[model samples]
Target: MSEKVISDYNGYDYKKEFWENVDREYEDQADRMAIRRLLPKRMEKFADIGGGYGRLANEYLKRARKVYIFDYSKTELAQAKEIYGDKIETKAGDIYKLPFKDNELDGLMMIRVTHHLKDMPKAIAELYRVLKPGGVAVIEVANKRTLPKMVRYVTFRSKVNPFSKEVANYKEISADGFYNYHPKYVEEIFNKTGFKRERVLSVSNFRSKTLKKVFKTNNLVKMEEAAQTALAPIRFAPSIYYKLRKPEK
Candidate 1:
């Protein structure tokens, strides 16, 4: 939240072209769907931290009075500017030291950014500071402990793992940069940052290319109904969605 904390985390140049490609490629279909679920009916001003390419920000603009899209990468901002025009504001800024005043934003959505953050607590505190009382924050993070993710780690040795030598050497960097998170870790971080946890949802409880193909058959609504009923009670869904709020009074 202070200048030093902000400065320390500012070294990652996400605005570069190469990183933008990484981010766009690593973008998750499930996260896009989850953000749609948590979106507010109407927001005065919404800020999206680490919103690469502004996909979610573009969607929020339709319902928000004003939208601000912040990312450390200028390359991503270029695409966002093309897609949004003047409807959305793009700023190359660090998430830890948001360039906004206290209680200045109505809502915040941080999609797939927790792992890239150098200090989760400081970043969340900044988000809490900028958000007005009753403002909501929705965060999307990969489940480090999920069965699918663990299998992927061992079998793929891909960008999803922060400890892999392949990823550590930057052979392949995930679109969002360094990401390492556990499913329940978010609750602890949010509570430490003064946000009260509200709702939690899971996505892609059972995800696989072959399984997805099966669900894509006859009726989309029926598939959704069946999946929700079957997976809603399960604790370890593939991806986790957290809805939190800044305390009022």
Candidate 2:
């Protein structure tokens, strides 16, 4: 890792406000569970790219012999080191510049991190570069084409165009700003990156406060599990999780 600042990550503190919101935690857990199911049943090594504090990659211990938690935050990596000392390897590296050599990993994950990336194709290619042929990658993307976004657009004439918006190119979340990608755009990214798409899981469908309050947490999780695949083709959820495999070329 070259210690270069990527995606306005120079001075952002994720440890503080990250765990503060209730819905955020629920949504995170939901994303983690959805990503977990897509992982290979067995693997020798895997890297969790941009996985802060090792919360998401920790779940990979059961499936992979060696688990690597890669992040851009040194403080968060230190905290992850403290939490998983000998169990996992923690690397503070930029997502644009992964520390590992080419085709060294049997599996990799990038959950809840793609939104921060300004160049989606480049980042996806980098991830594909590190993965071995026939390896699997579970990537979570914030969906621009979702039910709530479309409903609001039609009902209230909101500024958000969920149906056909490309990259927003703003500076809201980061200096380069974050992006909410349509599933079509994401599939295009995969197509250009030499990755074969397996399927898409529509995650975080019940992430709103009203839905959380109306249903128990367990029930919401159950509902999410049941509805994810059925809703994915239509892109009905706020988050879309893609399971992709590198072709054996």
Candidate 3:
């Protein structure tokens, strides 16, 4: 069998190059908002899977008694340690083979990490194995069937079919290992894994350069917050966030 294709960020300063330099405050805020809504208020143990440099640590730290930032990159974990200083524990490991034992975590989250995973089924099974019965997991996926992409496909501007369930690789246009998934395809995987879907949020609804140029960030965030739940059923956004729970029993 071939080895799994994982996105490595060892030497990369994702916090600086990806978040700070890119001016993606709107996307960042939107992500935080979605996480806050989904994450449980109180938990004994919670983890942020693939949480590089603990970017979303503040959101879960106050809620969970013990919070961990798990990633594959030691450099990113080191940076997280520097910023958090033991407030959050940092662990280095692969997603398919989590370090924790079965039913260990009370809650967990994976944001912007699923896109980098080539094997969704295997990765999600690991999430299921780690979470305790009735545990909550907030997962985010890069959506392929977004409104803009669908429009492009319908107008014959793009060859890729937005309605297909296959994973859409963006290596040609963007970074290697970057991928997008049809919402239904991901949902099917979650269902097969026995995770009960509780809530879905269509985040980053207005992620457009033109929209950012026209409106203030705060204004755009307000609109985004309103549209998240409203447009979730359609999964009309580029990023889809799901709140899932393992069955109690």
lDDT by residue for model 2 (171-214), tens = 65566566788888889989988999997888988878888778
Ten contiguous residues minimizing lDDT sum, candidate 1: 162-171
Tens-place lDDT per residue, model 3, 167-218, is 8887765556578999999999999999999999999999999999999999
User: What's the distance in Å from true for residue 245, model 2?
Assistant: 0.5
Candidate number achieving the greatest TM-score relative to the actual structure: 3
Best-to-worst ranking by TM-score: 3, 2, 1
TM-score per candidate, in order?
0.73, 0.90, 0.97
Better of 1 and 2 by TM-score: 2
> How would you encode candidate 1's per-residue C-alpha lDDT over 1-249 as one tens digit per residue?
232222222434444543455533213445555667777778998988887677666557777898888987776777778878998888788886788899999898987666566466677789999999999988775555566655666788543663332212121454434545655455677877888977776665545555555555234334443453355445355456778889997
lDDT leader? 3
Q: Which residue pairs show collisions in model 2?
A: none
When summed lDDT is taken over every stretch of 10 residues in candidate 2, the lowest stretch is 1-10
Task: Give the clash total for candidate 1.
Answer: 5
**Model 3 per-residue lDDT at 123:** 91
Per-residue lDDT, model 3, residue 234, is 91
